[model samples]
Target: MWEVFLYINPLCSFCLKVEQSIIDFTRKNNIDTQYHFVTTSNMETINDYMILKGMKPCDLEGRIGVTQDVYDASLLYKAAACQGNKKARNLLMNLQQEVNTNQRPYNDETIKLAVEKSGLDYKAIMTEKSGDAVKEAVKKDQELACKMHVEKAPTVIVFDDEDPTKPGVMINQFGSETSEEIINENLIAMLEKTMPHQISEPKSKYYTNDSIINIERYRR
Candidate 1:
């Protein structure tokens, strides 16, 4: 079993990309996995993320002025989680696609469309999204991010089933152009590092001189 904490900024392009990658990774690996998301509370972390990726502060300031949008989207994501994990993931991906892929504004209309696409209970989601409990949930996510020392959006921290107290392996700073395959590779590598026993060795008919050759070695 694995526990993955994915910290994201709803408005971040990199976050959207990594979100897809993480989804793909989870499906392909087929390990018993529980995943969670932590949303950014302020623009400071987003700014820092972009700057670390070589964005000039002056240019970035004008582009990422939608702090309120981020907060609202964060709340919506938390509210979506109340329904179920799958539905929440659908809503999150749909929302990101609308804003990042379709270039739609992250306003009420876009949010509504995303919720509809996700097959979510729109009225219930909206009501909960505005409640203090949802707001507190979002705040708690941010606090968890801080505790984990997450410095960038789209960061993934993977914990093995062995020790609950360990900090876990952190996967971060993928470039905007990073492919899902590459991200998956990184995830697998981290898993191997953290929980080697969980990874299955490929079976083969032939044996090496010393021992059976690992199928993974051929592609290396």
Candidate 2:
């Protein structure tokens, strides 16, 4: 099994499509994988990050129309992950589709709709949304991203095993017309280079305290 740390922002269109491609590629390859969807957008740096990633200022201004804060949306994503990673990933996919395809704002209403669509424990999530545990989870993810020196969304760090604490391979190049085949090939090549000797069973490790708590929550 492999673990991949994926840094993304709900407002990033490229991140949305690229993540879906990676997920599809992993499934097609029959790879046992775990995904950590780290929400990397902050209120301070989101506009600048978007522009640096090649989004035109005029277009961004038009799209947002007004100041749109994404911190709450990011926190919502972390809360969803508390329920389960798969559920969180599904919620993210739906949220991204709503934002990118339907031009929906990243707001409480949008998040509520995504939560409903994902079939997660809505009451639990809502209750925990403002709790310390959920806040810590979101903060931990952001801190991890900073520790990894991640400067952009859609950045993927692939580990040979389920533990991401160990050093991993980072994939920095994702083309405009990125395909599942291309992603699969790149991942295979990286895995080969990183894990030349295959181990029978690798011990799984969580990157943060919040991760461990979430896994336990899923089990209960």
Candidate 3:
């Protein structure tokens, strides 16, 4: 099994796209993957970062001026993760879809909708106790992001299952002007390099040399 640490923010459109691409890639390749979601910022300062990244502040729907609400969403995600990985992922996906499509605010109402969408026990996971634990988890993830020098959203770190001491390879799709296929191909190439023997026989359709070359060309 491979561990892929994905640093993401709820407001980042690029992160949303990249995460889905990774999920699709993993599913198609039949790769056993453990995904860790990490947040890089709260709502307080994310707007400035968005502008810096050449994105509109309004792209996140109800996220523009809401201070710490996005962080609250991250906490909600962590609380869901305590129940199970699938629940957590579903909540995150639901929240992202709401924000990107419906322009829903990252408030308690949105959290409720996400919980319902994820099929999680709302009363059980939305307590003060779970909130405290989620706060700590979010703090830990932020610290880990700092240690890894992750300054952008949608940063993926692929770790080798056998070699614990070796440094992991990081891949980012934040500022890339290329297509999602190229970004996914580069990410798959990095994963292949990390775990050479673990890849299955039938390759994913997106994993191709031409895509890799196209990504390199875009970089140049």
Best-fitting candidate, scored by lDDT: 1
- Cα lDDT of candidate 2 equals 0.65
69-104, model 2: which lDDT tens digit per residue? 456667777788888888888888898788767878
Which residue pairs clash in candidate 1? none
Q: Where is the poorest 10-residue window by lDDT in model 1?
A: 204-213
Ranking by lDDT: 1, 3, 2
Per-residue lDDT tens digits of candidate 1, residues 81-154?
Answer: 99997899788888888887788977889999999999998999999998999998887777766666666677
TM-score for each predicted model, relative to the true structure: 0.78, 0.71, 0.74
Provide the global lDDT of candidate 3 against the true structure: 0.67
- The residue ranges of model 1 lying beyond 4 angstroms of the native Cα positions read 42-44, 48-56, 59-64, 163-167, 197-220
Q: Which sections of candidate 3 miss by over 4 Å? A: 42-49, 52-67, 128-130, 174-178, 196-220
The true-versus-predicted C-alpha distance at residue 96 of model 1, in Å, is 0.3
Clashing pairs in model 3?
none
lDDT of 3 by residue, 59-150 (tens): 76634444365677777777787789887888788888887667776677877887898898888778832556678877887787766666
Deviation in angstroms for 213 in model 3?
27
Report per-prediction Cα RMSD to one decimal.
9.5, 7.7, 8.0
